[model samples]
Structure formats: structure tokens, C-alpha cells
Target chain A: MTGSILEIRDLRVAFTGAAKPVRAVDGVDLALVPGEVVALLGESGSGKSVTLRSILRLHPENKTRIEGSIVAAGIDVMALSGAALADFRGKTVSMIFQEPMLALDPVYTLGAQITEAIRKHESGVSADAARKRALGLFERVRIPSPERRLDSYPHELSGGMRQRAMIALALACNPKVLLADEPTTALDATVQVQILLLLRELQRELDLAMIFVTHDIGVGVEVADRIAVMYAGRIVEIGAVRDVIRAPRHPYTIGLLSTRAQGGRLSGKRLPTITGSPPDLASLPPGCAFAPRCSSATSACLEAAPAAVELGHGHAVRCIHTAAVA
Target chain B: MIFYASKRILFTLPIMLGVTIVCFALVHLAPGDPLVSVLPPDASQVIKEQMMALYGFDRPYHEQFLRWLWRALQGDIGTSIRTGRPVSTEISKAVGNTLMLAALATAIGFLLGTLFGFVAGYFRDTWVDKAASALSVFGVSVPHYWLGMVLVIIFAATLGWLPPTGAGPGGSEDWKWNWVHVQYLILPAVTMSVIPMGIIARTVRALVAEILSQEFVVGLRAKGLSELGVFGHVVKNAAPTALAVMGIQLGYLLGGSILIETVFAWPGTGLLLNDAIFQRDLPLLQGTILVLAMFFVVLNLVVDVMQTILDPRIQRA
Candidate 1:
């Protein structure tokens, strides 16, 4: 964990409004080293988003119960409060959301939001200086006519430009870590690759430890260095992106990888789909969440949720039968 | 922004023209005769015709409408059949009073409503939301004139702390800014305010809930803004819709104040309309209706422009 920018240990997040608390994130252990890009690969409701949001304490306080340690840039995230917590966000860590149209404030201009973020964290920064920094960030993101676009409202910009503005906003305070929640999912296919490249470029340039959440495996390959396959509310597998993709040990990850039309052999053939849906977090059964849909399931896999079994070179898999998928 | 505002304003021109036509047509369609109260019951045909000609009632409907429109454009709404004063002069005075009363009431309603709305919306499933929601419902459901009378009984007739009726001392209708005139304003303004208060509170509560649920609100918080800063953003998002509701409510209060005005004996357009209707004062009636209708048109124009300025999305639409 030395030189790690952000570390989340056994992080558990639950929402408490229902009859039973829904365990959105359970026993998630993750760390982001300087300049590392990790893609939390999962389908919808897999806790990928929940884990990303927990870092900034973005969930409603009254509704959510978060336990375990989340430390970023030497700041204990779970313990910080009031002004300190506020200062930590957009300063030590910042986030860019999936839908740029929904994330950017409709009423405020892009320039104003960026300047506000900059000025908010550093009280001594002059408005003019903050605005100049905002323009710089806009230019760094390669927005067209950064100055004019600065005054433009969210609705005035196209989706890709809006996402660029969003990235600019997130980077305004120069945070050590960036949490992107499916940042390019809401974009056009053409723009998606461009944004991925830009994000990858910025991550390298800023040496930001980024946790990129995406369901798209193709997107993961474009930007992420490591991949953490999430199922239900757990990270079932984690390793180098190349290793996870090529040598997936967990059955769920294997099924996810198989669903893609890899090349010529899969052309004109119906893509394979993982059978059965994700387990309901509110009433999860007493077993590995993927066991119901896993083709390699055994009675042992149904006994309890498997623990992480470490492999060489930092690859970890949580499975009673790791060799079954491999 | 200026161009958008100008475009919105230009769009209101056709609406105002339509309003004038409806006002003229609706008033003419009423059951009572405009000349009945002023003429003798057994007047000879010759005398009746002469009186009718004097008032321009002898002309066809289209001709009469054209003449009225021309004279109205020239700031001559003709003379009141009952009072003998110019209808323009009477209407202007009444409009001033109504504007003052409605503006004060709407301001109070808007402030209180927005406060309650934010409270309720922010604490959506809590006791504070219940209380604010209940009060808002009470405000909406209560008959305004009944509330006026009840308030009159409690604060005016029983305690004798304030006057029950009239716009000033000695029943004068002049509205000055001093406390004496302001006291006369309180009873009617408070009674009238509840309607908008309830309507606005409900409107704002819905608006706040919707705005707060939007991803931008979380985005604001994620950007390191304090709760207060996030609240400010929510307010800006809620303002345009809230203002639109308030503007429409203000229009209602201005013209729809007849019952409240009658109950309080406040000499606003409502009382003037009642007097005009009872006395068969066509000129005064027409003038009052026209001005009130115009108020609505103008208020809508102002709201549209203001909304465009407040909400960037509205400008494009």
C-alpha cells in the first residue's frame, strides 16, 4: 500500500430505508497507487457505482450506513466532517459522473462551476485567477474555443463537450485521485473512444489514481491498467487488465468476457449471455452470489460466499473453483 | 438574454389582442342591459333613441367595438354612466390600489411558501414536511373571503386592534406608504395571501423535490460545496418555475379579488367591478375588465422573460 493515493479496506455500504437494509457494497477492498487506472468492471447493480460513490461519501447520510476505512492522500475519508470533508472533495479526490447532461448544473455556466470549485477549495485564490485556471483546464481538456464554451450553459454544449467540461470541473482543484462513474457510457460510440483517450492522457499527465467504473470490457481495455470484476456487491476478481481478460478465473468474469463477439469465429453467431440475473441485494441467498447463474457451481460454492484466493503477480480470485472457468 | 426577452415580449402582443377581444365579447354577452340603470322605464322611443345615440349604442356591434377600441387607444375609456367621472381615471385609481395590495400579498406568500417548501422538500419524509404540507393545504382549501371575515372578527371586530374595512381613515381609498395606510392593507392582504401561499408552497415543494433529486444537485455537493451552497443551487433551479406560479397567482389575486374586496370594502377593481355591474355602468365595467386582462398579459410576459434569464434551458425553448 506504499505510495497508494487511495485505499478502501473492507468497505461496506448499505441503504437503510427499506424493510431490510440493502447491502449495496459489501466487503470491498481496493487500493489505487499513484498513476494507476483501475476499471471496476460490472453490470448494473453490481456495486461498482456504489463503491465509487462511497469514496466521496456521496450517498445521502440519513439513508446510507458506511463502515470500514477509506483513506485518500493520507486523509481518513470516513472520519472527516464538515469543512474538512468538503475541502477533501474536489481537492484530495474528485469525481466525474456518467451522464454529463445530468451532472452539470443547467443554470450555471461551465466557467462559473469550475471557478466555484477552484475558489471553494482555496479561499485565498482570487476570482480572476480561479477563472483563468478554469479556462486553462477547459483548454487542457481540448474543448473547442475554451473561452466561449466557458460561458455556455450545459444545454448549450454537445454531450462530448459537456463531458469534457465535466472532466475540467473535476480536475479544477488538482485532486490526487479521480473517481469516474461510467464517464463515457452516456456518450456516442465515436466520442466514447476519444474521451477514453483524453482521460487516459490526463491520468498519465496528472499521475491521478483513477477508479474508472464501466460495464463495457472494450472501454476497460482502452484506459484501465487493472480490472476489478464486481458481482452483486463484491469484487470477485482483481488483476492486471490483460491478465483478468485473458485468464479470467471467476465464472462471472468468464461469462462476461464470453458475451463479447471477440472476432471472426463469433461473427454471425448469437452472442452468449450469462444466465439468470444478479442476486437481489436485499435478500441475497447464503452462497456465492454468482452460483445461481454459474455453470461451474458445486454444492461447496453454495455453502458460502468464497474468499479471495491470491495468485501470483497480484491477481486475486474469489472462487471455490477458480480452475473451473480457466 | 436581451434578444430572448425581446422575443418573448413580441409573442405576448398577439395574446394581449386576444385578451381584449375576449374581454369585450364576454362583457357584451352578459344578461343585463348596459343602458337600463340610466334610462327611465317608460321613456318614449324618440328619447330612448337619442340617449342610445349619445352613448354610441345605436351603432352596430362591430362599429361600436371599433369606436371603443379607438377611444380606448386614445386613453379615453369614456365616462362612467353612474359616477359621471371618466372611466380611465376611476380604473387607474382602482388598478393602483389592487396592484399595491396584490404585490404585497404575493411577496408575503412567495417568501413564506418558498421557506416552507424548502423545509418540506429537504426533509421529505419527516415531521417538518408534514407540518408545512398541512399548513399549505389549509391555505389552499380555506375559502379566502371566509378567512377574511374570520380575521376581521378576531383582529378587527373583537380585539379592535385594527380597522375592519376601508383603504384609509374616513373610508378614503388613497394608498400611501405610511403605517396608517399599511394597517388598512393588512386584513385584505393576509386573507388574499393564503391562496398563493398554499399554491406556491405546494408548487415549490414539488419543484424543490424534483430539483434536489436531479443529479446536478449531487454534482454540486460532490464539487465540495457545503449544504448551504447546494441549497443555493437548488433555489436557483427552483426559482423559474416558482416565479411563473407566483406571477399567475398575482394575476388571479388582482382580478379575482372581488369577493375579498367586497368583504373588506377595499376599493380595488373587485369592488369597482361589483359597483359597475350593479349600476349597469358599461364604460366602467369595460375599462376595469380591460385593464385587469392587460395586467395578466403583461405579468405573463414579464414571467416568461424572467424565466428565460433564470433558466438557460428556457431561453432555447
Candidate 2:
């Protein structure tokens, strides 16, 4: 983490608005070097999206309490307030959301949103100059009839085109790091591959570090360099993509990988599923959260939450029975 | 845009036809002689027959409808039984006064409602939102006629700072924009304003809250927009529905002012309608109803076009 572009230490995000404050993210530690693409893979309520959003401090200011330190591009992200926070966002890092249509302003044309983002970050740029840059981005993202598509509202475009427009919008200011929060989840399966490929190409072309959050292992393999599997607000396993997927050390990761059909062909037998559901984040146990559903769970695993233990070559696992999973 | 507006206008024609039919039906449905107030009390049945024939009431229903519709189209709405003036003239004057009052009141209501709505919505679930919500609820729940009377008691009767009735200085029929006439308007206009203020504030509050909850708001903030810039987007997104509410409120105020105008004795169509209902002046009643209904139709058309212009999601084919 010495030369990392962004580093997070012991991040804990809790939503105080609820009757009982929900700890959405607890004790998360991550670092991203420039040009690295890491995928946070988890199912719903696994804190994958929450961790990504917290990197941008996107939670409501009054209703949420974030306890931790985050430093990005030599700037203390957690210490920023008002104007400083505004300056840090989009100029240093930007995000692409899951739903392109919902993420875009319905009233504004795509061109206007892009130009606005550019002008907001770069003060001296005129609207015309900003729009020119937006047009260039539209072309860079391979949107057909880029000039005409820029003027169209999000609802006017096809699913793939809207996702491209959104990607173009995200890249308008050319930030160092990009956050893709299930960017292709709301798209058609056919269009999903196209957007994924486009994002991968642009992430490389721009030399931008990206943290992609998705549940699909196929997508993680397609775009991620490293994979971090989260279980109930903690990264249970993290390593290079091939290492984690092929040699998963955690029981939860093993169960997750087992649930998917191996070679895209149905065996006709039931696809194996983990026995129990994920733990409620509001009231998690002191021990490992996945122990209730873990097939190899031991009585010792119920005593305490296991810490992340490093293996060789940047691979790590957090489980009392890592050897049992292997 | 022009095509949309024109198409919306064309759609109102059937609604217009429906209004006329209802107005014509009112004559037949009511249980009284049409010429009772005009003819001599002790006259023979021949006089009644002659009067009925003279006014074309003796014609077939369809013939009578066509004639009434024709005259209404030509702006010859007949003479008022209560005033002896042409129904059109009385309506035109009352409409002028009502239009002026409606404009002032709606402007006040819209500005205050929008301010309160944005504040409450932006700082939702806070004390400011609570206070605004309470005020709007009060506005909506309180009977405006009662409020108008209370306002008159405080500002006009007890304080003697303003007039309690009449449309202008000198007790004249003409309305001027001068302070003397304007003071007469304040109590009633404020009274009329509360209805829209309450309804619009509620409508806009919900609109703003929903818009803010949408992911685009996060997207806007994520793109480095200042809170002010985000507010601008919320306002634009909320505007189409908010203004549509305002337009519909204005239309309601036109006819719904009967109780308010009676409380103030202001010479608007509400007061005209009140007098027409009492005196059984069918012609005046029919004309006012037609005009008010037409105002509603046109207002809806205008609101539809405005919404289309503001929200691209609602594009009309």
C-alpha cells in the first residue's frame, strides 16, 4: 500500500437514520494502486456497494456516521468539508452507477450533464469548450452518431447506448480512479457484455484504477485483476482473480463458487446452495458471520471473529478453517 | 411543441361540447318556469305561450340546444334577470375582476408554497419541514370563507385600516390597480391564496422529496455539483408537476370563489353566480358556468403543454 493512489483504513459506515443504527460497512481496509482493477464480489447486503459508495463519501451527511480515515491522491478524504469535498469528487475520482436511466437526470440532455460536470471541475472552461470535450468522450466511448446522441435525453437512447452515454459522462473530467457499482446489472444480457468490454477498454486507455462491485463471477473474471469476496461487511477473501476463484481459501467463497453451474451446461441435478441465509448486518454475531451457513464450521469458529490471515503472493483469507476449505 | 399544444387544444373541444350540454340540461332539469320572473303574474296562459315561443323555449330540445349553443358561441348570452344588463357584459366585468384577483393570489401562493416546499424537502424531517407542513395543513384544513371573515374582522373591521367590501374606491364597478382599490383586494386575495398555497406546498413537497430520493441526485452530487446546483436540478424536475398543480388551482379559484366573494362582497363571478343562484337568473348562471368550465379546459391544456415542455419523459405522440 506504500505507493497506492487511494488508501482506506478501518472504514466503518453506519446509518444512524434507522431506529437501530445499521452498520452497513464495518472494519473495511482496502488500497488501490493506479491502473489496478479490483472487483468487490458479493450478493445483496454484503457491503460491496456500501464500501464503494463510502470511498466517495456518498452517504447522507446528517443521517450517516462514517468512522475511519480515507486518503486519495495525497488528500485526506474524510477531513474534506463543503467546498473541499466538492472539489475532491469528480476531479479526483468519479462513479458509474448500476442503472443508467435512473442515474442520469431525466430533464437534462446527456450533452448538458457531461458539459456541466466538465465546467464544474475546470473553472475556466466555457460551455462550448466543455461540450466539445463531451463530444470527444462520446466518440471515445464508441457511441454512434456521437454528435446527435449527445443532445438526446437518457430515455431516448437504447440500453447499451445509455450505458455508453453514462460511461462518457463518468470520464468527462478524467479522474484517476473510477468506481463502477454494478454498471451492467440493469442492462440486457447481450448489452451487458458490450458495456463491460467498453468499460474495460476505457479503464485501460485512460490508465484509471477502477473498483467494480458485482455479484457475477463471470464479470469479475472478464474485467477484474483482483477479486475481493465480501461476507456480511467484511472481505473474507482477497487475492489475484485467478488465485481466489481457482484456489478459494474461505468456506463462504467455496460455497458461492459451488452454487454456480460450472461450464454453462446444466447437470440436471440441483445446483448446490449454501444451507442458510446471510446474517443480518444490524445485529451480527461476535464470531464469523458465515459460520451459521458454513458446512465446515467448528465450535471454535463460534468463539470469535477470525482476522484476515495473509497467504503467499498477495492472497489472504479470514476463516478459522481455511485449511478445511482447501 | 406547437403540434402538441394544438393537439391538446383540439382535445378540449369534446370537453367544451360536454360543458355546453350540461349548461343546456340545467334549464330543463330545474323545476320552474323559464319566463316566470319576466312575465306578468296575472297574465293569461296565452301570454305564457307567447313568452315561451318568443324565447324559443317552445322549440324541440335539439332545436333549443342548437339555438342556445349558437348564441353562446356568438357571445350573445342573453339578459340577466337580476340586473337587466346583458349577461355577457356582467360576466365580462366580473371575469376581469376575478382574473385580476386570481392572478395576484396565485402568484403569492405559488411563490410562498415553492419556497416552503423546497426548504422542507431539502431539509426533510427537520423542524423547518415540520413548521412548513403544519402551516400548509392549517391552510388546507381551515375553511377559506371563515378565514376571509376573520381577516376582515382584524384588518378591516377592528383596525379600520382597509375596506371590508367592494371592488374599488368610490364603491364603483371599475377596478383600478391603485392602492385604494388594491387595499380592498388584500383580505380576499390572501383568503383565496391559502387554498392553493396549502395544496401546492404539499404537492411540491412530495415532488421534491421524490426527486431528491432518485439516484440522479446522488449522481449529481457525485459529479461535484454544489448543493445550489443540485437544488437547481430539483427545482427543474419538480417544476412541471408543481406548475400543473398551480394551474389547476387557479381554475378552481375561478368558480370556487363563491364563498370567499360572498364573505367579502367583491364583484367577481363568484358573487355573480351567488346572485344568479338566488334570483334564479338562468341566463347569468348558464353564462358564468360555461365561462368557468371553459377556463378549466383551457387551463388544463396550458398545463399539459407546460409539463411537456419541462419534462421530456412525457412526450406526446
Q: What is the C-alpha RMSD of each candidate to the true structure, in Å?
A: 1.3, 1.3
* Alpha-carbon runs more than 4 Å astray in model 2: A264-266
DockQ per candidate, 2 decimals: 0.87, 0.87
Pairs of colliding residues, candidate 2 = none
**Model 1 TM-score (B-chain only):** 0.96
lDDT of 1 by residue, A84-177 (tens): 8888888989999999899988999999999999989998999899999999999999998998999999999999999999999999999999
The CAPRI classification for model 2 reads as high
Across B1-317, the per-residue lDDT of candidate 2 in tens digits comes to 88777777888899999999998897679999877877778989998898788778899989989988998899898878767899999998888888878888898899989888888887789999999999999989998888998988999889999889887765647567789789888888899999899988898889999999999999999989998999999999999999999999899987759999889888888998998888788888888898889999888888898899999888643
B1-317 per-residue lDDT for model 1 (tens digits): 98887887888888887877877788789886678888889878898888899999888888988888888889898899998999989988887888888999999999999899989998897999999999999999999899999999999999999889999984655457888888999999999999899999999999999999999988988999998899889989999999999999999988958999999998889999999888888889888999888888888888888888898898787
lDDT, candidate 1, at A221 = 80
Against the true structure, whose lDDT is highest? Answer: 1
lDDT of 2 at B165: 84
Q: Quality of candidate 1's docking, in CAPRI categories?
A: high
